[model samples]
Structures are given as structure tokens and as C-alpha cells.
Target: MSTTTALPHWDMTVVYPGLDSSEFAQGLSQVLQHIDELASFFAEKQVQALPAAPVLDDAFVRDFEQVVARYNAMSDEVRTISVYISSFVNTNSQDDLAQAKYSELQRGLTLLAQQATRFTAWIGSLDVEALIERSQVARDHAFPLRKAYKQARHLMSPVEEELASELNVSSGSAWTKLHGNISSQLNVPLKIDGETKSYPMSAIRNMAFSEERDLRRLAYEAELAAWKSNAVPLAAALNSIKNEVNVISRRRQWESPLEASLFDSSIDRETLDAMLSAARASFPDWRRYLRTKARLLGLEKLAWYDLFAPVARESKVWEFAEASNFIIEQFGSYSQRLSDYAARAFRERWIDAEPRPGKRDGAYCASLRADESRILANFKPAFAGMSTLAHELGHGYHNLNMLKRTALQRRHPMTLAETASIFCETIIRHAALGQVEPSEQIAILEASLQGSCQVVVDITSRFLFEQNVFEKRQRRELSVDELNELMLDSQRQTYGAGLDEAMLHPYMWAVKGHYYNTGRSYYNYPYMFGLLFGLGLYARYQQQPEEFKQSYDDLLSSTGMASAAELAQRFGIDIRSESFWRSSLDITRQDIDLFEQLAAQR
Candidate 1:
């Protein structure tokens, strides 16, 4: 087994010098001034009326851009401190200063939220089309900004919104703390190699994906037992937060939580349906792959824990540096610009790769002030780790593209957010598959398809579970058992006859944390949408290599500006059409066929 210390650690000071330096402090002070100015202006003038239209006055345009620039620069400093503090906290949860810094930052964010909401509400009240008639750029951006404020307006009655806004600092967001506390602090007592050791749930739960069946089963049982102990409280946290979302949705006049989320994501109901339908249609293929794995392992049926068991006869070892080079080289072949970006990020220590104590579990890529992107991961030096690097690097690529756009324009909808990362994985996976032998190909394919199954089947189940939980929780509180049943039913619907009935994870309602979000409604479908969308684009790339490059870049570059469907239309892909999504799934089906053929030969 690989030691955890082998994981990477990031050095953020490379982004900017000392935070206490004169220049840094000056920038921070300037941002504070801008925030106060904006807050006071909005608070005083915009009572029920929108701020002056930017299009009608050139002075407003210049001032507004200045306002944005100041905010962006300020945000960069704030993010630097946040990334530094959070990174430290993740690795060393015991660090007092890190915790202090984090708390201080949270308080600061709460203030910013209040200031931002008032400004946005003021903006959303303006007649966007009329305002935009005067300035094309302002007009072009009007719809998205107006839509954002409109969503913000739904939080509460102006009075209740104010109250919730203040209360969130201590109460509503506390739900995440509950989930995180249980997840990060819970220890699962595991017997590994005749030694009984207490492994934190975050660390040992990942072993369920191990190639060794006994280890996988042991880990699964232990994880379930640990979570079961805290199931009631977990259920409560989920119920309370989800109910909060429902109430907020109702007050906003939104019909359903799903509709509210889709509106926030800038995606429509039909596109979501199309994405889900395509995923549902692809399950037979996934089941076929699962059965093939079960047959290889000489088992009668596959359980949830066996879903990620390796298929290749050989286990390839990858060191961190080797994995980095492999990913960069593959990405370089597709686009030199992208390759260069990856090179700079790594060379400059922008990524915190080496895992250590107190570092956060899981992986994420966050934008640093829209000027840079920071990637966090506990890399394991396996095929999955390599793919994770590609996946995260894809996010970096996306951020890089969007950074050049306006501050308001830099924010992409959640639905299209995963495009570059998934696309990058597709590119790397296909390339690696072509070069490797059949046995290696089987391993690679299983890993790839298993990941797809997660976003498709598992995520869909989450979508359904959250939807049902929210609906019921609106009227009443559900006991832990009720939530578990809902989770089990959702899993059954998505997995169908593929997974062993007796082995379904009911405590999933307690485990997966996406439902706990107070803001977004269905944080689930976006994963499936991004996967299929990227694959659809990848399919086009295969058909028209050169032409697809420009088109693909253009699509990613405009993610902040266009609706998800509008972006799709640029490539002649109708995202609302089930046929388009099906085509993407068809590509996955084709990959599964090749996987089965390779597995049988092995």
C-alpha cells in the first residue's frame, strides 16, 4: 500500500509575495473601500428602483467596469488568503491559526454576500432590454446579471432575506459543518493484514474500490457500520437544509426546487430531461460491463463495493512526476496552448499535489481571482490519479479561458462547468487505450466506464433522492428510516437489476453531501450533462478534427456568456433533444463493447 505522505503539497506563495506586504495590504484596503462605496450607494439610492442603466450613460459604463476591476483585484487577494488557509486546514485540521483565518474569512464572505445581494437586487429591477439598447456589451451581459439578481431576490422577503442572510452565518450553513464534522472525524475500525487500525472514514472508504475483493468488502462493511451510527443526525441535517431550500423556492414563487436550480444553472427543464433519459437508456450497457467484471472475478453477482474493482491482469505503477508528464504530453497533443497552461501551472507550484496531514480529502480546482486557477488533490499515483489530474487540469483550462472575460461573464453555469475536465479525460483515456495491450485496455476501460456510471447512474439516483426528499420535507420531517428508504428506492430506479438488491447503500442519504447545499436545488444532473456534452463534443472532434478544435475552444470560452443550450447550438448539437444526448451515450456504449471484447480475450 502507498503511504499518504507521497501525495503532493502546493506552495501558494508563488502566486503572490507576502500577504502582509505593502502592495498586498494596499490592494486589500482598496477592495474594502470599493465594497463600502457600493454597499452605501445601493443601500441609499436603489429603494425598489434599479441602479442607473449602464448602457444609457458612458460614465456609468466606465464606473461600472472600474467597480468590477476593483472587486476582481480584491477578490484575488481574498481568495489567496482563503486558498492558503483552507489548504492548511485540510491537511492539519488542528492548526489554530488556520482555523482562525478560516473563521475570519467566513465572516468576511457573509458581509460580502449582504453587500452583493443588495446591489444585485437593485440591478435586477432594471429593464434589461431597454438598458442594453444603449450599449451592446452591457445589453449582452444584462440577461445573465438580471437573472442572477432575480434568483437572489427569492431568498426571502426583503426582511426575511435580510434575516436569513444574517442567520446563515451561524445556522443554515452550519448543516455543512455537521456533515463535514461527521465525515472527517468519524473513524472506521478496520482489520488490515491482521492489524486492527482505526482509519478515518474519509481515508479508508476509498478502499472499497480496491482490486482485492476481501479488502473491498471489509472496507465497505466497516464504512456502512460507522455511518449507520450517525445516520439519524445525518438525516436531520439533510432534511433541515433541503427543507430550507424548498421554503426559499416557495417564497421566490418558483414552482419546484428542480425548476429553481435549472434556472440558476441557466439550463431548461427539457435539457435536464434529455440528459436523464440518455443516462437511463445507457444502463443496460453498464450492467453488461458489471456482469463481465463479476464473471471475471468468478462471482454470481456484483455488489456496490465491487463496482470499481480492477479488470486488468496487471497493475501498473505510476509515480507522481511520471503521471504529470504523461498528462501534459497527452494534453499537449490536442492543443499546445492548453499544454503550455498545464506546464506553467505545474512549474509554478500552482497545484498542491502532495497529500499530508490536515489536508482536505477529495479533489477540486478553484479559480484564484479569475486570473489564476488553484487545483487541490490527494493524488494516489494510480490510473485513477492520472485521470483525476487530467480531469482537474480540464477545469484549469476552463478557468483560463473564462479569466479573459469580464468578471460577470467569467462565471459559467454549473451545468456546463465540467465540460473541459471531462473532455480532457476523454482525450487522455482514448489515447492511453490505443497505445496499451488488450489487458491494459480492459483495466483502463473499466476505470473510465465506472467513472461514467457514477455521474450517470449514481448521480441520477442522487437527483431523484434529493427531489423526493425535498418534496416530502416541505410538509413534514422524515425520520432517518424514511430518508433511507427514499435513497434505496432512488438507487433501485437508477441501478435497476444491475446491482445486487440486498447490497444497495441506504445510508447513501447520509454519505453523499451534494443534497446539503442550501443554494442549488438539484446539483446532480449537471454531472451527467457535462459528461455527455463533452463526449458529444469529443465525437465531433473525431469526425472533424481541426474544425472541432476551434469550435470546442469557442464553446468553452463562451460558457460564461451563453445558456447551456445556446452553447450546444454552436456545434449544431441540440442539447434539449434526447437524440443528441443519446448519441453521447452511444459513444459510451461503443466503448463498453470494446471493453467487453477486451475483457473476454483477457
Candidate 2:
């Protein structure tokens, strides 16, 4: 195990010396002033949604461009300051100053949300084609413009929209914070290795990857109990958040929270339906892989924790440096640009790879300023840790290509945002295969399959669970047992006979922070979108590396400017076509076939 003290803490001096520094204070003031400027501009132009045409003249061009310029700069400024302060808060949840700063910034974020909604509603009132024909700026941003215009049909009254935005700060946003603060600080009481230790939830969760069945079982039991004891608050938080989404979605005339999520993710109903249909078709294959694993372990079915248990002859040790080197090298085989960007990230101390008291669990890559990014992870000397590191660095690589785009252009939706990361992960996994021992091969194959199963199968469960929860939330609040039952039913539907029904993780609703999010509901499916979309791209890269290489970076850079289908179309992918998603699922099926082949050797 890697000690927290031994891991690197990220350097944010690239953005500011410190929060108390004059530079930091100045940046904060500038964002405030910019907000004021924007508000005045809105007021001066009487920028409410007009029932008339888009004033498609030189003055319209001037106002739209001016708003774009100010809004973009302000967005970046706010993001820089937000990410900087959050670096400290996320790393040390106990930091009072960081917590205070974050709370202060929430006001700014809320105001920004209000302004954006107002702007979108105003744009929604316009005829998108006339707006584009009237201005060069509009033509350049036709995608978001068109989207805003379409979304206008769903807008509430301006007063209602503003009220909803403000209430979200205390209502939805506060509930999310409560969940984060509690979950991050939660610990499970477990007696392990002859000592009774109160382990943090993340540490306990990590035990799921242990080779020892007893350890995994103990940890699983402890985790469930911990979440159970904490269920009241967690359940309340979820109910509050989901109900808020329901109310807001209803007010906006969305059929469901899933409908709102689709609009937010820049995906269409057809694409999602096709993806889910293909995913359903592949469930049997995933069950075969799971049953094989269970058979290898001499069990009829896998317990929830056994899903990630190592079935290889031996687990490989991976120190942080070794893992970094392997990922960089593997990435280099695919793209020198990706490899070099990764090297810079590590060299510049751009990652905080440590799990410590007060530090949050899991890993994420957040953009700082310009194209620079900071990554956070809980380092472990195992394959899972290394892969997670590579996954996050892939996000950094995405941000690297996002360099020099305006704020709006760089703002990729969740569906497209996972593209570069998944692509990079596939590169690493592919490189590992065909170049290792049978034991090592089994290990790699099982790990890869584990992820695919989650993205395709487990994610389906989450989607169903959340969708049902959202629907039920519209009627009334649910008890913890209800949430658990919903979760188990979802798991049973998707995982089928692969996992022991009795051992299914009913508390998964409490475990995943995704479900607690008020804004980004149905966050689970985007991983599926990314995985399938990325796999399809990887297939192309193999067939035409040179041709694919040149256009790949451009595709990532323009994620914000195009719809998901439009981006896929540039590369001859029809996202709405069921066969397209099936092709991606076929790649996973091949992995299952290889796993079956290798299991026979054992």
C-alpha cells in the first residue's frame, strides 16, 4: 500500500500563489465586476425573451458578440478561481478556509446559472436560422444557438427560472453538499488482520479488489452496515435532491428527469434507445463471463464484492512510478502528442495522487487555467489504481487539446466528455494484452471485462434505478428500504444470474455520488456513451491510424461546438443507428470470448 505522505500533492501556484494573495483577490474581484458588467448589459438591452424576430441586424451582431466575449472570459475566470479553491477543499475536506471560500463562490455560481438561463431563454425566443444568417458570430456558434432556440420551448417564465436558480443554491445544491460532506467523512468499523479499525469508506471500498475472499466479504458487510446506519440522512439528501429535479423538470415541461438529462447531455432519444437496446442484448454474454469467474472461484454465483476479485494466478505489483511509466509508454504507442502531454502532467506535479485523512475518495481531472489540468487519485500498488491513474490522465490529455478554445467551445457535455479518457484507457488495456503471461493475461482480461460489464450492465441498473426513483419522487418521498429494493430490482434486471441475488448491493444508491447530483441526473449512461463511442473510434484508429490521428484531436477540441451525432458523423458514425452501438458491444463480447478461452486454461 502507498502511504499518503509519500504521494505527490498538486501544485496550484500556476494559477495563484495562495487564496490570500493579491493575485487571487484580484481575480475574484474581476469575476464579480464582470458579473456586474453582464447584468448591466442585460438590463441595458432589455435582454428578456422577445416574441419578435432576433433583431437580426448590425446591432444584434454587436450585442451578441459582446455578450459572448464577456461571458467567455468571465466563465474562464470563474472556473480558474473555482478549481483553485476546490483543489484545497477536495484534498482536505477539513480545511475551514477552503470550505468558507467554496461557500462564498456558490453565490457566484448561482448568479452565473441565473444569467445563463436568462440568456438561453432570450436566445430561445429567436428564430435560430435568422440569427445565424444575421451574424458571423451566430454562424460560428450555430450548434449551441440552435440548441438554445429549441430549448426555449421548455423555458419557464423569466421570474420562475430565476427563482428556481436561486432556490437551487439552498435546496438542491445544499443537499448535494450534505451528501458529499457526509460520505467523504464516513467510516466503517471492521476487524481486519486481528485489529478492529474504523476504515474510511474509500479504504473499505478498495478492499473489494483484494484477492482474499474473507477480506472482501468482511469489508462488504462493514460497508453496508455503515451506509445503513447513515441511511436516514443520506436518504433524506437523495429525496430532497431528486424531488427538486422533478419539480424543476416538470416546470420546464420535461416529460421526465431522463428527458432533461438527455437534453443536457446533448444526446437524442433515438441514440439513447439504440444504445440501451444493444446493451440489453449483450447482458447474456456478460453473465457468461461472470458465471465463468464464479465457477473459477468454485462458487455457483458471485457475491457483490467478488465481482472485482483477482482470478489470475498472482496480482502484479505497481508502484506509482511504474504505473506512470507504463501508461505514458502505452499512450505513446498510440499518439506522441498524448504521451508527451501526460509526461508534462507528471513532471509539473499536476497530480495529487494520495489517499489521506480529510482527502476525498475516487479520482478526477479538473481544468485549471488555459489548457492546464490537475488530477487527483488515491494511489495504490495495484492494477486498479494504475488504470484509474491512466483514466484521469486521459482527461488531462483531453484538456490539453481543448487549449485555446473559448469557454463555450471547450464545454463538452458529459456524453462527449468521456471520449478521450475511454479511448486512452482502451489503448493501455490493448497494449497490455498479447504481450504478457497467461496469468497476467487473465488478470488484464478480467479487469477490462469488469469495467465493460459495469459501463454496460451495472450502468444500466443505475439508470433504471434513478429513473424509477425520479418518477416515484414526483409522487412522494421514499424510505431507505424502498430505495434499496429499487436498487436490488435494477441489479437483478441487468446483472441477471451473474451475481448472487441475496448479495446484490442494494445500498449502491448511497454509494454513488452520481445519483445525488441534482443537475446531472442519469449521469450513469454517459459512461456507456463514452465507452461505445470511444471503442468505435479505437476500431477506426487501428484500421487507419494516420488518418484517424490527425482528426481525433480536432474532434475532441470541438466537443462543445457540435452535437454528439454531428461529431460522430464527421467520422462516419451514425449514433442513432442500433447497429453502430451493437458493433461497439461486439468488442466487449470478443473480450468475453477471450476470457472464456483463457478460463479453460485454468
- Highest lDDT against the true fold, candidate: 2
lDDT of all the models against the reference? 0.76, 0.87
- Give the CA lDDT, 0 to 100, for residue 90 in model 1: 65
In the range 1-602, model 2's lDDT, one tens digit per residue, is 44323678999987789877899878777777777777778778756778776556788778888887877888888888899999998888778888887888888788888888878888877777877887877787888788887888898999998998888888888888888888888877999889998888888998988878999999999999999999999999999999988888889999988888899899889999999999999999999999999988888899999998988744467778877899889889987888898888888999998787778888999998886899999887767677888889888888888887788778789999889998888888887776678879888888889988999999999999998998898889999999999999999999998999889998999999998888789989999999999999999898999999989999988998999999999899999999999999999999999999989988
Model 2: runs farther than 4 Å from truth? 1-5, 20-22, 313-315
> Using alpha carbons, what is the TM-score of model 2?
0.97
The segments of candidate 1 whose C-alpha lies over 4 angstroms from its true place after superposition are 1-5, 15-34, 44-77, 149-156, 355-357
550-582, model 1: which lDDT tens digit per residue?
A: 777777878888788888888899988999988
The TM-score values for the models, in the order shown, are: 0.93, 0.97
